[model samples]
Target: MKFALNSNLRPLQMALLGSMTVVAVGFAGSAMAENRVTYKSAKAGTSYYQMGVELAQAMKEGTNGDVIVTLEESQGSVQNVMEAPSRKGNYVFTTPPSLVAAAENSKGAFEKKPDEKYKEIRALFPIPSLTMHFVTREDAGIKSFEDMAGKNILVGKGTFSANEGTKYLNLFGLDGKVNLANVELNNAVPALKNKQIDAFVTAGSFPSPNVIEAAASLPIHVLSMSDDQVKQTGAARAVIPANTYNGQTEEIVTTSLPVIAYTTTEMDDGTAYTLTKTFWEQRDKMAGNAPWWNGVTPEMLMNVSGKMHPGALKYYAEKGIEVPATAK
Candidate 1:
């Protein structure tokens, strides 16, 4: 076969080739990077969810949408840390007891060895919760933990409150005396009002919303933490002064649970660094959504306990903040 092309054919071929290349580039641009990270927590409607949304919004605005964060709620604090970096979420917000347990070389707790998977986790921040308050009727004559030794106590398994409080209970030899009931707070609260359970042990923010609501209808007293008790547990605690919450004119003293909010070390350092930087830089936007993030500062992030990635260390140093004392 013989083929003949007119001189006009050369320019048309070049234009067609250019059009194909341009279309290819456009499609690649539209694919978008899959850099979204998930954050998980338990306790529906708790402050952690609010904090997570704030963080996600900060990520979007900071990178001009290059990175994103999503929240997965209602997983127990312990579960949040374990499954986060691997499956549902990359970030875990929970109490330190659980994170410390996750670090344990315990069998069957983590899917992979500490070096392979556990090392992926890092402590990003501390939320700082308070101890499980043991609230009894004021006239019950129970002014301190010593008084509740032989009474009914409420607890749920796997709660940080249960784990830590049990240790102290044993130390004082009250573990055998208290009639331990494995029940939810809701079920136990009503019973306490009816003289069923002497006191309920629960870990929550000071002026527990449940305790506050219960007090509006009935009278109750939150047991005070003795200096000896605080020293024994060795966990950071705070006091809920009298009138800290509505309905109680007198101080409702309690101790802090002291928790940490963490992320997995498994994520690429660049991803971790960007997240750490963007969250702090755009913290005002985050604080708008969840006032809980309000107290955080750039200097605060530099002082966290767990391992920090090299990239995160670099960003902190550039901001005139020193690297964490133990950063590698």
Candidate 2:
């Protein structure tokens, strides 16, 4: 077909197409960078908080700021774990069984649809957490978990721990034996001093200044979980060695919140790979800045029961470990 093209129209069309391609490329690059992953921690002024700040700094230094990480200080793991994908945060300072806790209480913590109830967060690395401290008056004589049944317990109420032990204790069929008393951090110490509460379970990974101060002055006791009970709490609990707490010695055993390093499904496989990489590559810098960062290792992040994120999985696949189907 013989046709005469308008030269002016041809150049305009070419220019238009070129502009569209440039826009497309720019759009893709922006998306890649803007897909930021946030890491949240239970509370501020704690080791978990310090480690998270170190991690974001490491990401900025390692990737030259290609990955902008946000650190959202949170109430506790119970709340932080649910904030991922809500634009609240991505990674979290959580314990071994946080996902288990989320799974059991999905509707309670997450924005649940009948269809999608679980966040299924992955364990990135294990951050050593503080004691699941059962601080009690020395005269209380509450030496065992069974003994906790009938006594008044001072728990951090309307917050992360949310008296989780009460549920577990009830599960153990110890209901009615333990009187439940919930209070915030402000009144907890005074209540214990006045004998208003028999024992208090405080979860802290960093230097819990108040609790530690309380321990020093009150002549308190830290209780231990038997080996069998340790296994039963699933991923959320771990047996801390005796002497973990000051002032209370003599194999006063206790279980700690497993403080696992974590990230969300929002992070893509490649980005997750970089984060998982930075988490290890900058371990020294992080640990130097914060003691809790010392505990993280490659194996601690992977080799867990839950599935890793796709980005994390992609990183692991290089080491010849295939992520399970649930992970994808």
Candidate 3:
């Protein structure tokens, strides 16, 4: 026999059901508040991509999982900038200030696909600079840029190193006198070991993995550039401290292209502030694990191009970190 609801118990049952519904809604709302940001950087296995992975972990843990970061593979900085205009939600990417300047001016790679939306890009935080490493085989007898005049040098094709190496060779009047190896950077170490190339130019943060590998496997020398030479290249000056690699004894001065994490106006002020704040607060922690991150400092913020995201600016202002007027 079907039993009818007892009138006295009906009120208690309704109240219990209402309370349960309210608790469920609260949990759902909390879940919805979690933010997911897409981070696009270099291709897999590159230092930048690895940094993205570390940063993602730091963000998740530091925020107590309120913020989640997802890393995406990118061809290079140009491709990252190209996607910024079309990307929605909270999107972040890393690139050199020069590329941002070019994109803003619709020059170089951005010339054909220039979009007004590019103007919305904003700076978040500075990352490690792409420091140049002029690694030469010890037996090659190369001590400086001038020594590469007759040596076989491998500057990986279509990379920043290749472009800068060409410019430096021409600047020092050794253009045609040197043999530039045409090969991928992944082959540089093997090529150098096999005596196919006497030296190679690679760009990454120091201690650059490739440089460390070269220095560890064979006797190597990192060429130093004069202050005047670095100035002529028109890139940021960087110094690889002594013993950065296995056998390196003296600091090697070189040029670097500053890279920065960037986002667009689509992100809310709160989220931007959280990201910027978390980055600085957790930077030292990140550095303890990855030495490359140790290179990042508040002073590097001066290199940031475009305007700063308001949230990031807020953090800087609160922390008394001086930001460039141009980035303000």
Leading candidate by TM-score: 3
- How many clashing pairs per prediction, in order? 15, 13, 0
Worst window of 10 by summed lDDT in candidate 1: 294-303
Candidate 2 lDDT over residue span 1-328, tens digit each: 2344666577888999999999999999887775466576757876567667777788888887788878777886656555544543355445455454455355454436222423556656556555566677788888777778678887666644445555557655677877778666667778888888888767665335556677766877777667676666653444444444466456544445555666655545566688777766787876676654554445444335456666666666677654445545
Tens-place lDDT digits, model 1, residues 71-116: 7776665566556446533454554544545554433455354534
Q: Candidate 3: minimum summed lDDT over ten consecutive residues — where? A: 1-10
List candidate 1 stretches off by more than 4 Å.
1-34, 43-54, 57-66, 73-115, 128-131, 139-141, 149-151, 172-182, 193-195, 205-208, 240-244, 248-254, 281-305, 319-324
Name the better of 2 and 3 by TM-score.
3
RMSD of each: 4.5, 6.6, 2.3
Task: Write down the lDDT of every candidate, Cα atoms only.
Answer: 0.63, 0.63, 0.91
Q: Show pairs that collide, candidate 3.
A: none
lDDT of 3 by residue, 1-328 (tens): 1345577678899999999999999999898778999999999999889999999999998899999999999999999999999999999999998888899999999898888888999999999999988889999999878889889999887888888878888887797999888768899998999999999989998778989889878998989999999888888899888888988788889999899999999999999999999998899999899889888999999998889999999999999999999998
Alpha carbon deviation, residue 159, candidate 2 (Å): 3.9
Q: In what order do the candidates fall by TM-score, top score first? A: 3, 1, 2
Q: Using lDDT as the measure, name the better of candidate 1 and candidate 3.
A: 3
| Alpha-carbon RMSD, candidate 3 | 2.3
